[model samples]
Target chain A: MKQKRHETPLEAIDRMTDNSVVFVGGFGRAGVPERLVEAVCRRKLRGLTIVSNNAGSNVAGIASLLQEGCVGKIICSFPLAREAVAFRDLYDRNLVDLEVVPQGTLAERIRAGGAGLGGVLTPTGVGTDIAEGKPLIEIDGRAFLIERALRADFALIKAYKVDPLGNLIYRKAARNFNPIMAMAADWVIVEAAEEVGIGALDPEHIITPGVYVDAYCAVTRIDQMMEATP
Target chain B: MTANCGLSLDQMAWRVAQELQDSWVVNIGIGMPLLVPPHVRADRDVIFHSENGIIGMGPEIEGGDHVDPDLLSAGKRPVRLMPGGSFVHHADSFALARGGRLDAAILGAFQVAQNGDLANWKLPGARTGSIGGAMDIAVGARRVLILMSHTTREGEPKLVDRLAYPPTARGVVTKVFTELGVFAITEDGFVLEEIAPGVCADQVRAGSGAQVKTDGATLMVPPDPVSPREPVLSRA
Candidate 1:
C-alpha cells in the first residue's frame, strides 16, 4: 500500500478546478477545513457545486466562497441561517442555485455513494415537497422515496487526528459529516489538527480508516483560521 | 397588553415539558423547544439529542469561560454533556431520528394547519427556505409536537385553516402548545383542550385564524405557579 501524501493546504486545494463538486465536512463550525476553504477562496475557482450541512455561517469557512461568487450551486440540508448573509444575498439575486435536502436523507445519500450502493429508500419526504419528481417505491405496503447517492470530485474534511497512514479520529460533535464524505470523494484532503505516526491511532477509536484519505496537511495556524467568520 | 391573560414563554415551555414521558429520547428544535430541557421533570430520565451529534446534552456551560470551544449544540451554542453522553457522526445522528429511535421532537413553527400540516421552514416569496432538519425530525420522530406563540409577532394568529407558506411536512404535527391554549389535531380540526388563566375559549377562538372547536368539552385552566423558575439556558 502506498503512503498517504502530505501536502500543504494550498497544494491540496490547488488540485480542484472549476465546476467540481466538493463535499465540505463540518456541522456549523465544528469540523470545517478552515485552511482548505481559505485556499479555495484564494484560488478563485468558480461555478463549483458544494455539498454540506449549512452554507457556512457569517463567520468564515465556505461563506467566504459564497461571498466571492465561487459557488454556482449548493446541495445542502440547511442552506440558510440568520448569520448566512453571503448565501442569502447571492440566493436572493439568483446568482446561486440551492437544493435543500432533509438532513438524514443528505447523510444517507453521501453514505450510499461511499458504499457503492445504487440508492437507498427512505420515508423522510414522502408527502412533502422534497418528494416532488422523485420515484416512490412501496415495500410491504409502506411508501419510500428513492434518494440517489451523493459523490463529489473532491472532499475537504477536518479531523482531530490523522495518522501518516491517513486513519482519522474526530473530536466530540466535530465528527459530523467528515467520516462519510471521506469515502465518497474521488480525492479526499483532510486538515488534521494533529498528525501522529501510522500506529499512533488505535484501531478501535478510528472513525475513518487510512484507505479513504488521499492527502492530509497539519493544521499549523489555528488562530488565523478560527478567527475567520463561521 | 392583556395582563396575565396567557402563559408566558416559560409557562408554555413548562406545559410542553409536562407532555414528555420518562426515559423518552427527545430532539428539541430551536426557539421554544430549547426551553423545554430546563423545565423537564428532574425525576424523569430523558435523553436530549442534538441533531449536530451529541446526545445526553446537559445545560449550557456557565460564564462562557469554561466552555469547550469545540462543543456546540445543533443551534451552535456552547452546551455541557451530561453523564453517559455519547457523540455520533451526522449520519448516525439523523439515523437516530429517521430510524424511529427518537420518541418525540418538539419543534417551533410558523403556522400549523388544522390538518396537522406544518409550515415552519419557509415564508412566502423567500428565495430559499432554511429547511434544516425540520422535515426529517417532523416525519422521523414517533410524535411531533410544535411549540410556538399562538400569534405572530404582529399579533396575527399562526393557527390557520390552511398554510400560506410551504409545509415542512404533511400531517405530522400531533399537538401544538401556545401561550393561549393547547390544541390537538383531531379529525374535525384544532380542538381546544385547555386554556391558560385569564383567557377564555371565546378569546382563543377570536385570536385563532382558523375555527377552534370547543363543543361539549370543559376547558380546564392551567394551575398558576407561585413563581416561574428561571429557565436554565442550554442551547441557543
Candidate 2:
C-alpha cells in the first residue's frame, strides 16, 4: 500500500507559481485554510486568480492576500464585506477583476468540473445580467443558462480531521466549499485540525475520499497567522 | 421604521408567514425574508433550510457566548439547530435546491415586474451585488414569495412594468408581500389580493408602478393568535 505524503503548510504552498488559478474553500470565516493563506500572502506570488465564496473580512484569510496585492482576479459569490477594505480598494481602483456568481451555480460549476461533465444547465441566472453573454438553452420547455465547469490549478482547503490515507471529514458547516473544491482541482492540499490513523475515520463519514486529496498538514498554529495579521 | 401608509416590517413578515402550509420545507433569502421565520405559526411546523448547508434551522442565537461560530445560515447569521437538523456539503445543499426539494422560498426584492420577473441582487451603479443563492431558490422552490417594502426609500414604487435592474429570475415571483398589501402574480398582471387594515386600494395602486387590479379582491384580516380552535398537529 502506498502511504500518504505529508508536508508543512509552507512547503505545500511553495509549489504554487505565479498566474495560477487557486480555489480557497470557506464560507465567510469558516473552513478557511488560515495557515496556507498566510503562506500565500507571505510568499507574495502575483497574478493569481482566486475562487472563493466571499472576500475575506478584516481578519487574516484571503484578505491578507488581497492586502499584499498578489491576486489579479477574484471569482466568488459574495465579494462585498463591511471590513474588506483590501478587496474594496483594489476593486475601486480597477486593479483587480471580480466575477460574481450565484452561490448554487458556483457549487454546481465546481462539481461539474470534478465529475468530468462539460457544464451544467441551471435556471439560477436566467433573465438576469448573469445570463448576459452566456448560452441559454431550453430543456423540457424551461429555460436554463449553461454555466461552464470551473477547475483550478490547485485547491487549498481546511478540514477538521484527516487520516494517513488522506480521507477527510469536516466540522459542521465549516465543511462549506472544501469538499467540492478538493475534487475540482489538479492538486489539493488540506490543513487539518487533527490527523488520525488510516482506518480511524468511518467510510461513510468521509466527505472527501483519499483519491482526491494529494497532501495534508496537521495545523497547529492556525491562529498564529491570524494573530500576526494587523 | 414604520412606512407612511402600510404595515410595519413585522406585520409584513406575519402576512408572508400566513402563506406557508404545514410541513413545508422553506428556504428564506437574506434581508427582509429572514424575518419570516419568526412569524411562522407554531402549528405550521415549517422546516427552515439555508443554502449554506443547514436544514431545520432554529432562530438566531441572541448572544455569542454559547453560539457555535461555524453553525451559520447563508446570511452569515448565527443560528441554532432544531432537533432533527442536518447538514450537507455545498454541492448537496444546492442539489436539494436545484433538484426541487424545497417547497417554498421567501426572498427580498429590489423590484418585481408585472409578469413576475424578479430583480433583487444588484442596484444600478453598485460595484457588485451579492447574488448568493437567490437565483437558485427563486427558480428551484415550488413557489417563490417576496417580502419587501412597497416602495424604495425615495418613494418610487418597486412593482414595475419592467425591471431596470438585473433580474434574478424570470417569472419566478409567485406572490409578493409588502407593507401595504399582498399581491399575487396572475396572468393579467399584479393583482391585489389583500390590503392591510389601514391601507386602501387606491394607495396600493398609487404606490405600485405596475397596474394593481382590485377586481374580486377583498380586505385581508390578520390572523388572530389568541383564538384557538383545534389541537396542534405535527408532521413527524
Candidate 3:
C-alpha cells in the first residue's frame, strides 16, 4: 500500500481538476472538511458538480466555492436556508444548475454507487414532483421510484481520528456522510483532527478502513479550522 | 389573543408530546415540533430520532463549555443525547426511516388538503424551496402528524379543499394539531376530532378553508405546559 498521507491540504488537493464530480461531506456546519475545501477554492477549478446533504452556509465551506464561481451545478437534498444565500442567489439567477434529491434518496444513491449497485428503488417522493421523470416499478404492488447511483471523482471528508494506516473514526453525528462518501469516490481525501498510532484505533470501532482512503491531512484544532474566514 | 381561546406554542408542543406512545421511535420536524421533546412524558420510552443520525436524542445542552459541534440536531442546534443514544452514518440513519422502522413523524406544514395531502416544502410562486427530509419522512413513517397554526401569518386558513402549493406527499397526513383544534383526515374529509378550549366548532368551520365535519367534535383537554428548566445565571 502506498503512503496515503499528505503534510498539507494543498498537497492532498493537487490531483483535482476542472469539471470533476465531487462529494463534500457534512451535515450543516458540523464535520465540514474546511481546509481541504479552502484549498479547492484557492485552486479555482471550474464547472465542478458538488453532491452533499445541504449547500454550504453563506460565509464558508462550499459557500466560498460558489462565490468564487468554482461550481457549475449542485446536487443536494436541501439547498435553501437563511445562511445558504450564496447558492440560492446563483440558483435564482440561473447561473448554476440545481438537482434536489430527497435526503434519504441522496444517501441511498451514494451507497449504491459505493456498493456497485445499478440503482435504488425507494418509496420516498412517490406521488410527488420527484416521481415525475423517473420510472416507477411496483414490487408486490408497492410503488417505488428508480434513483440512479451517484459516484464522484473525488471525495472531501472530515474525521475525528485517523491512524497511520488511514483507518478513521468520526465523532457524534458528524459521522453523517463521510463514511459512505469515502467508499464512492475514485480518490478520497480526508482531513482528520488527530492522528493516532497504527495500533491505537481499534479495528472493530473504525468507521472507515484504510483501503478507501487515498490521501489525508491532519489538523491540530478543529475549532480553528471551523472558525476560519473563507 | 384571549384566555384559552386556542393553544399557545408551548401548549401545542405539549399536546403533540402526549400523542407519542411508549417505545415508539418518532422523528420530530424542525420548528414547533422541536418543542415536543421537552414535554415528553417521563415514563414513556420514546426514542427521538434526528435524521442527522442520532437515535436517542435528548434536550438542548443547558450551559457549558463542553458543546460539541458534532453533537447537533438535524436543525443544526446544539443538543444532548440520552444514556442509550447511538449514532450511525447518514445512509443507515435514513434507512431506519425509509425501511418503515419509525413509528411516527410529526412535522409543521404550510397547507394540508382535505384528502391528507401535505404541502410544506415549497410555497406558491417560489422559484425554489428546500425539501429537506419532509418528503422521505412523510411517505415512510407509519403515521404522519402535522403541528402548525390553523391559519397562515395573514390569518388565511391552511386547511384547504385543495392545495395551491406543490404537494410534499399525497394522502400521508394522519392527524393535524393546530391552535384551533385537532383534526383527522378520513375517507369523508376533514373531521373535527377535538376543539380547543374556549373555541367552538363554528369558529373552527369558519376558520377552515375546507368543510369541517363537526358532528362528533368534543372538547380537548391538553396537558399542562411546562417550559424546559435551564440553569439561572447568578451575578456575583
Candidate 4:
C-alpha cells in the first residue's frame, strides 16, 4: 500500500469537521502534534469529543478549543493544561465534563479499544469512587473493576518519522498513546515530523504499520502550535 | 496524634512500611499506601512496586516538573524510578508478586475482620466489587500490612469483628493501622499495639469491633519511627 503524504498542515486538518471525535497524540508535553491541534482550532469545529491521555501546551494543542469552548466534552485519564482564565470560566460554568481515569486502566482501556474488547477490567479502582456504577465481573471470584471502551472519529497522532508507505516511528514520549490510539480510531491521520521517502525507514524501526495509518502529513514546525508556558 | 487533619491516611501508611524489616521488597497498593515510600528508613532499602511495573520507586512529584512518560504508578501518575530501578512487562511485575518475591505489602483496607481478613477491594455502592492484584499480592508477599483510615469519611469505624465490604485477601493482613493506632491480628484476636499519644485505649477498643489486646500487661512500646529510604516524589 502506498502512503499518501500531505505537504501542508492545513491540508491535513481540512479533513476534520464539526462534531468530530478526535484523539490527539501527546502525553504531557512530548510528541504532541501541535500542527494538527492548531489546524483543527482554525477549522472552528464545535462539539468535539477529544479522547487523549492528557492535554498540554495550553491554547495550542486541544487547550485552545477548550479555551474557545469549542470542544463539547473531554474523556481522558487527566487534563490539566488549560488553567487560563478563559478555560477556567468554561469549566466552572459546567461547560466541560471531565472523566479522570486510573492511568493503568486508561492505558488498558485504549488498548482494549484497539483490541475490540467489550470493556477492560482491572482492580485499580475497585474499592474507590472510580468503581462507582461500573459493572464488576469476577474471574475465579477475584474482583476486577470495569472501565469501558473509548473511541474517536479521528486519531490525530504525531510520529517522529514516517516512511512513504505510512510506516511510522515515534520518538520519546510520543510513543506513549499514539500507536495504540491509531488502531482505535475510525480515521487515523498522522502528522510526521519527518518524511522518509518510501523504502528509507528501516522495517525494525517502524512502530506502526502502514495499514493503521490513513494519511501522513509532513510537519516542519510542530513547536509553532505547542508552546510551554511558565 | 496530630489532632485529625485528614493526613491520617499517610500517617497509617508510614507505620505500616516501618513494620517491614531491612531489605524488604514491598509493594504498596495505590491510594494511602503510596505515601509509605516517603516514610521508610533511609538505611533500609524499601523497594516500592507498582503493578504497572518498576521497583525501587522514588518520591512524590512536584506539579509540572519533568515527568517521566515511561514510569507510572498504580495511580497512573508519572513516577520517578530510583537508581537501579528498571521497567519490565507489567505481567512480569505481577509475576514477581504472584511468585512471592515481596517481603511485605502495604495495601489500603476497607474493612478488617477480627482475624485480620481484608476487604479492601470492594464497596457496597454499585456495579463492581472485584479484586485485582491484591489476591495475588496477598498470597505472595511474606507479610501483608493494611493501611486505612480508622474511620469512614462519615466517621464510621471500619475495623470490625467481620467484614462489611467484599473481601479481597482472606486472613492475609498481618497488621492494621488507623488514625488511632496499630493493631496486630493473631489467631487469638486483634491485638492493640500502638495508640496515637492522646487517644485512649478504651476509644480504640470501643471503635474497633474486634477484641483488642496488648503485649501482656505492659503498655506496648512502639518501634522507632524512621524517615523513608527515598523520597517518594522524585521525577522518574
lDDT of each: 0.84, 0.84, 0.87, 0.67
The sequence of per-residue lDDT tens digits that candidate 4 reaches over residues A1-230 is: 55367777778776788888888866555556777887777777899888765533445676777876668877665444333344445656878766655444655677677789877666555544666799888999877777787777899988878877788987533455677778888888898877877788888777789888888798765442342221
- Number of the top DockQ candidate: 3
lDDT, candidate 1, at B33: 86
Which of 3 and 4 is the better model by DockQ? 3
TM-score of chain A of each: 0.94, 0.93, 0.95, 0.89
DockQ each: 0.51, 0.48, 0.54, 0.07
Q: How far does residue B153 in candidate 4 sit from its true spot (Å)?
A: 9.7
Candidate 4 chain B weakest lDDT stretch, 10 residues? B217-226
- Residue B209 in candidate 2, Cα distance off native in Å: 0.4
Give the candidate number with the greatest lDDT: 3
Worst 10 residues of 4 chain A by lDDT: A221-230
- Higher-ranked by TM-score: 1 or 4: 1
The TM-score that candidate 3 achieves is 0.94
lDDT of 3: 0.87
- Model 3, range A30-107, lDDT digits (tens) per residue? 888988999999999999999988888977889999999999999998899788989888988999999999998999
Candidate 1 CAPRI grade: medium
In Å, residue A157's CA in model 4 sits off its true spot by 2.9
Q: List, residue by residue over B59-80, the lDDT tens digit for candidate 2.
A: 7766545566567777777777
Q: Which lDDT value does model 3 have at B21?
A: 95
Better of 2 and 4 by DockQ: 2
The stretch of ten residues in a row with the least summed lDDT in candidate 2 chain B is B226-235
What TM-score should be assigned to candidate 2?
0.93
